[model samples]
Target: MTLKSVFVLTTLSLAAGCHGHDHGKSEGGKEGDHGHPHGAAAAELPGQSVTIWAQRTELFMEYSPLIVGQETGFAAHLTELPSFKAVTAGMASVTLKYVDGTTIVATADAPSNPGIFRPKLLPQKVGACELLVDVKSPQVTETFSAGPCQVFASADAARKALGEEAEAPGRITYLKEQQWKTDFSLAVAEQRDLQNGVRASGEIRPVAGKEARMTAPVAGRVELASPAPLLGTFVKQGTVLASIAPRPSAASDSATLAADVAARQAEAAAARAELGRAERLVAAQAAPSKLVDEARARLQVAEAHLDGASGRLAQYNANSSGGAAGRRFQLRSPVAGTLVAIHAVTGENIEEGALLFEVIGLERVWLVAQVFEPDLPRVQGARAAWFTIEGYEQPFVVDEKTSKLVTIGHVINPRTRTAPVIFELDNKEGRLRIGNFTKVSIATGAPKSALAIPEAALVEDAGKAVAFVMVEGEAFERRPLRLGVRSNGWVEVLEGVERGERVVTKGAYEIRLASASGAVPAHGHVH
Candidate 1:
């Protein structure tokens, strides 16, 4: 054979050998690769691993568009999840499955805030649904399910209903506000106080003419012959309280009696002689008319003297026996009332003008209260007033006529710097006292209805007031609010918030913190 032919045949045998070896290896690799692309196609397909940061088992969740409010930062997280393999940006949907076998679907769309997935309402029912995710995978044939989402409308509400496990990460739950309608108190606007007023402490006091005192008119010993039964007793008109027997004036009585007896005896002797002379003069016809007249006049004078003597004797006898002498007069209550104080003792001598008894009529009582200078203007025009006593929390009506502003003191109290404003109140029940402190609220003006919210829902930072409103499920956005008057625990929301919007009331502090950390996303609402 020639040299060129020998070389060509050797090369041909080597080429065949190389080809056979390549064929065997390629066939073996093909079998081992399964259905996956051998080159770029397998690498080009998306890759993702199932990751559940945390699981909150059996959390009672509500699934509704209302749950996906504007405040929740849920949109950003949903959009970011699409970056993971097998998940597309707009293809994802979240559903809540309640323990009671109810379901609600939530869809993701382009959020106004970049990269945030604005949620579209799939339904309005608040229940539960399984969240299934379908993504293209090279190694797997079936789609992946995200297990169960513990969705809730609010963190605290969910925690209260489903316990602490509901707060687990990535365990979104919906809080149902079933109690929102019922668990609220209404501030109905009627004729109630509007502006702020100062509260001042004060007490009721007794006015003059309402209080009375009884005293002895003359010095005398107290007698037990009072018509009233007891010492601290009540006496009406004409009821004798007590009487004192007089001590005898013996010398004056004896002088008056002697003068009366002597005068009476002389008058009797003169009258007998005059009658005898007058009868003889008339029978004999010897006396003149003038003499007869004179005799008759003398007899008339004697009889007049005797009558005077008899009256004087009778007066003297009564005085001598200590019956007509200075004696204790019965003391009676000048007014009909309750016996409050009794100073006179049984069988004790009392000086004239001394205090004997004190009585008070409980038919009406004054309700005095202090008014601060600042609040005085508002109260001055109050048509009605109300007050509550310590023991009685029930407020009673105070009419303007019965409780007018009697006086406003010129001097303010040194400690309180408040003027003592007295209003006469009619406490016919006698429940009030001279020094019982009372809580008074005056109906100074008419009431008007205004948009209002609980003060707790507000977040005060610097001078601005803000509130976190629930947007989407478990997400909240901070919103500025214009505030007006505040009464009790409620504040009137003048602007930036409307009625019926679900707002973050309890967890505002935490929401603010989340917002500051950028953990909360500002997402616009679709519903």
Candidate 2:
């Protein structure tokens, strides 16, 4: 969250990623010099070490106090933020601004080792200097301004100004090199709302008003549209789905239908004109508003008759021919969606009002949960929910943004002694199926605000819930947690970690393996 001046930039709650390559050779051509993982700079840096967070990157830097005319080595651990991965390739420059306008700058072409960029500065001016770091990677160009920095005249002056400090106890060294090499991530333990949850068996279903069923309009044989719709074919509303040719009958003549449509059109136009005239007269105060309302009603009735007449004529205009046979009726989808089901096949004879096609929108879906009658009282004030499906390790969350509670059904099943609680969820990713069975965790009860970390951050050690709290860039502390109620991917921390502390979330397993290996810090990186 914060840091101070010097030849470094880093984030407080930082986890590192492994470098793509580390050849283990220092910049000075020495076997274990400044560039090597076992370099002299690896020893506990004597001056200020801070972690700073910028918009696009996190910098964890350590430097032995900067002395005039002396090569000052800075262990600049640069991690790309949000993803919390090490910066593999980039140019990192450290600038020290003096009281005068001039400055001292050091540059590193790439990571001294991946995630660690060593930029050495030889100061010419011995006074307090403002520190700034500029980094240019393939993905980002970011700068960080750390607070005030100090430059001493000599080693004695540096030693006297900042004395010795003790290292933290029980430090577990998990180097930045190891972090970059694995699937690692870091997150801050912050206050979150934790609630008691109720578990229920649920089924995914189509949302209301997003599905439609197209049926036969008359007794006829079916004729599918060109490039006929198959199951799962996406179709838009009012699109021609299929047509039904009625059996030969005197009343089903196409010419008669056309004549009826023309008559209906003329009647509709006359009614529309009457309504316009009535409205204008009412505005002029020459006619009562009741007459205007009656004319409007007559127009609506006429329009409805016209629609029916037009539909009959449209059937003949469609692909159906009524030579010696009756007219054909067209069946079109009323809503936009996928062709989920088709009950009739092309050229198949079917009766009027028989089911033909079923279309249902699936962009969003509903999870209908059956809550036990006894638990109804507890779930009345539900706050959030999560559901687990097959093949998914992480459960999908159901919150106000992504989902809504449609209803807690009033009617209870007499046999099952349960009520249906429906939750509508966005399914733009097509993850949920119409008939998927899922186990849902419905958060209920009053919310409790407490410090919490991701459930993935925890490691079961000696039968205790433990997590690796990031102590610094290259160090971590295995803290045993006293956990409270767990819900929706976060575990409440009753103890053992503080607010704003970063913990490893993704690679905790590998970090635990590193701890068990008992490898020296040199085995990992030059920390």
Candidate 3:
């Protein structure tokens, strides 16, 4: 016999065996038929009906009725694979096969409930019967079959038999092929030397000696130099910032000083002429040698007085000719930095030693933290720190290579009970602004190894810390975590996750939403 014929004969034999038992009389006709009296005679035949359950392509299928000329029902439950939640949106169909090599197809309809589909089937000749359920959703299409279920005399018997073989819940089977279609990425939990740190409030400041206040050198009217310096203007050392012209006053006026210098010059000229005359007379025996020597001494004294007056006037660029142009002194910057403040404006009369400009170098900065007295020892012993400036999203790091601990205040504030702890950081980028409030964490204690993951990898699920761990290429399991110290961008994982296991990092929140909603459309790809 052919293989097809042999399979048919075997199915027929099994069906016969199923109906062999007498339903009318148990053994001695002691009881009337309690099970499906309408099909009592058929139930006596060996294999009148059967029920079976099968899961195919993520849809669950249950089939009943193995005998010919018997009505059968096929129910299909559409669900997402791995997550087994009911998929309410889909189309399903059922195909029925008979022993006579004939087939019938019917569309499945949803009952009052969603995700549950029912297709009707009535066999004409029932040596054996088989069913195939096809389900299609927007994301995928799948086919499932429970080939040739044995038909029982009653529906109750079939339900009872199928219940024993039902699948377990909470197990999902996400495929690797589908994972690539969504925004999914993973990171491995690693053993790292994480620092336990203390958090403190602080502010960014210009380092001491790195800032300077330019003051008026003398009492004068301020005249801004060309290309006037404004607030935030960067200047170099010795760059002329402004000019201070001496104000004409009774005490010391430029015109009066000029007259005095002229008078002194005239006196020096007269003395030199007198000395020359005296020397010539002595040579001709017209005067005594002592008289010539005395004239020479007097000329020297006058010349000395003239030099003193000229040198004094030169400091103000003063012109003895009494020109206002030579009466001003140029004020230059003493340091290279940005002008943070301007105390005196152009044409303003400033007094001697008055504040004019404040220049501050920003290539380096100070983070001054107000450390509580209890934590002062930790702040002093900390090897490094991470600080966040106001208005910036990222934290700036300060380590031995780029920073140093400059001081710890000896006096604590009486009101706040806190002392200043200072750290210097390189600010070459100028991202840190002076006087801005900061949040600081100083790493303290000895270095110790601990399992940690990126802070981004953590998410909250029902108020518990959760992370997603990749069990397979595409399958992920939600893990509750016990977190320890958090330092820098990493958080120590005290429990729930293991070292070397890949966890979702960049898209952890996305996964959490998917797991919560039981529906995840295509997400962005992780590069």
Candidate 4:
């Protein structure tokens, strides 16, 4: 499997079970205003006559053109007032009737854009007021009532009123109604191969099979008869390491020689007597059978003694002739491996069964892994797996012969709370080390395709999981979604989005802030 990046950082995907919040105003704001649930600045103005013009839209005019002049006493009053183009480019004259028996008349250039209108004067009555707008255009003429007007004498006062209005019922820009967005990304999962299934801290380990020391069976002065291998040397099975020569002291030398000679002479005499006895018995029809049998038995015993004497004498001669004064014993390697340690010096005497040397087999190595309780189930039946060594960063797969879990420690390790799970790894390629630590990953379950995205792409809004969907140019909308199984770096999107839609995969927070601030443009297609 391919990982796109190793150090990639992405946002965490909120689980489908979570929730998100919206901070926008409710949908009840009046027409032609930032009806966001959050409070916004109010419409500024002067109270006067409102009149509709003949043209539908006039560019850079004093009043909206789509509206016709309602011929009233106030409309006549506004015609005589100082006229200047309104802030909007295309507005014409329009007249409105306040419910309080007063009229406000105004003229603008055109109606290319729609916005709230405030005459440069306030109505006589206080509190809220509704006025009727008589709009006329080349195509059609329409009349509509404009609300519960919040009128103030100055811009600052209007702004304050707007704030209060925002908090009041039926106001737009409610904070609870807004939605925020975020982006997400994905990367490959890192892999490691632990051979000694998760090792726990402080687990007792016996020296490997060959690390134990083996000593000479008998005590003697040691010497190498040939070019014997020493400490740090490698030996094959049955290769002799050294030879030991047993020496004779001044007191024991003469006695050993005399006993040897006597044993030889006795053996010879006994053999001759036995041969004569057997021949005579056969000829005389039975010198008693018992006597002949006894003589033969004695002869056999004598011959064995003689053979032992000869072998010992030969050993002594070989040692004395070699500038050494003792019978030598050969110390051979019991197993094939490298000699790691030695306690014996060339001239030092060693006791029987004393440790002399240590050997190790390096052909195979162990990779130990510390299996955490949660991870144990996943690796239970894993036959083949791989891991990466820390220094090498190279991954090695467990060989089939050593892939099986050799052991699972019974007692939980108190320190690490991990159990030992061991597997053998091949070192023939020289790629693995006996004690190197590695990170491992096992394919615990079968792979299946699911709708997935980077976790970062999700954000919480009003306790719901949401992502930003890029709708029109530079415009994104918050979308609620449900999530499913996640693996590697990708989270499964179970709902609220479809494949191929460019959900914000990055810079989602900034986009959300802009939307809440009204920096985002509303689509002309919005209902």
The number of the candidate with the highest lDDT is 2
- Top candidate by TM-score: 2
Q: What is the lDDT of residue 469 in candidate 4?
A: 65
Q: List the RMSD of every prediction in angstroms.
A: 27.4, 12.4, 17.8, 23.3
Q: Cα deviation in Å at residue 355, candidate 4? A: 3.1
TM-score of 2: 0.67
lDDT of 2 at 383: 50
By TM-score, highest first, what's the ranking?
A: 2, 3, 1, 4
- For model 1 the TM-score comes to 0.35
Per-residue alpha-carbon lDDT of model 3 for 67-136, expressed as tens digits?
Answer: 3445544445454543334555667777777666677776654421354455656655434556666667
Full-model lDDT, candidate 2: 0.76
What lDDT does candidate 3 reach at residue 486?
83
lDDT per residue (tens digit) for residues 30-60 in model 4 = 3422221111221121122122222221111
382-454 per-residue lDDT for model 2 (tens digits): 6579888877758889999888899998999999998999998999888888989998879987788989998
TM-score of each: 0.35, 0.67, 0.48, 0.33
Select the stronger candidate by TM-score from 1 and 4: 1
Q: What is the lDDT of candidate 4?
A: 0.45
Report, for every candidate in turn, its global Cα lDDT versus the true structure: 0.46, 0.76, 0.63, 0.45
